[model samples]
Target: MQNQAEIQKLLVLCGTHSQTAFEQLYQQASPKLYGTAMRLLQNGELADEALQEAFVHIWHKASEYDPEKGSAFAWMATIVRYRALDIIRREKSQQNRSEAMANEQLALQQGEDFFIHELHVDEDQHLQLLQECLKALDSQQRKSVLLSYYYGYSHSEMVTRLKRPLGTIKSWIRRGMESVRECMQR
Candidate 1:
């Protein structure tokens, strides 16, 4: 539903390699695509890596986008998602990350849905809401939230990685969640 003109331009540029069109397209859609990759990948580094790869793919695969099937944004999203998933599957470093994510899934099956709020995010507006809520928390609290929810780090892992006490990590998560909830409600 967005970037119809840009997509048309991209379609034209696809065959011509127009840098201006590419830059325009990147400016219009990178945030949503990056946000989607971040939510899917969890790690900021991985998300950024995915974002880079996705843009490369966009450059190469722009000709394949068929707006008749869906929006141009949707087409770009699919390419980005595929590229991100492929990176996680193909690269050794990301494969380990995938394993860690798998372990987290197993942990979730034990009825310990402490990360339940993550499941509620399903919209672009929610991302904006998250950014707003995150701004309200302290730096450490914000990092803790992003690490846990965005990166899916376990509480203990976050504590160890952050060099903070377990209690502090727990407090950060709870307070961050409370703050985000209050902000979203308002």
Candidate 2:
């Protein structure tokens, strides 16, 4: 089970879409992949989602695996890591959107008392602070951050929408978020 030869043989069988081999490979590899996902995501629910996506990808992409590029386990682990990262990013974006919407609705409907009661805010001071912080960011950063957090756009979506490199888009979102957090903390 822990042997490279066994893994490579299973991978070959998997390339032909052998159900038994897939099952066995899953049995042999799932625990390690699940552990990796859990470590990266830090939430069981998100980790589960990552693991599911990773397996779906593995099923489809098994034939594409190249031993020259890496070992079967390394290739699979890469898939799992990327999947987990994507899940975490999406979850964080969703959380940010939900919080922003709730804050807006709470401010409009119930005012600072609800913030104090529900969110433990001292006053209504923080309302619009996030918006202002967002406004302070550069255009690309602001757009990337808003698209990602407000609209739940993935990094790839942001890259496509913003017509930017993936690395640049990721940087914009990361830096923009840092700026927003810093501004809100003021």
Q: Write the per-residue lDDT of candidate 1 for residues 81-138, one digit (tens) a residue.
A: 9878876675655456557656655654664432343455545676667666776799
**Which is the leading candidate under lDDT?**
2
lDDT of each: 0.75, 0.80
Model 1 C-alpha lDDT versus the unseen true structure:
0.75
| lDDT tens digits, residue span 17-95, model 2 | 9989999998998898899999988888888899889988998889998888879998988999999888877777767
Clash tally for model 1? 0
What residue runs in model 1 are displaced by over 4 Å at the alpha carbon? 91-186
TM-score of each: 0.46, 0.59
In angstroms, how far off is 26's CA in candidate 1?
0.6
Residue 15 lDDT (model 1):
44
Worst 10 residues of 2 by lDDT: 108-117
Q: In model 1, state the lDDT of residue 148.
A: 85
Residue 149, candidate 2: Cα error in Å is 12
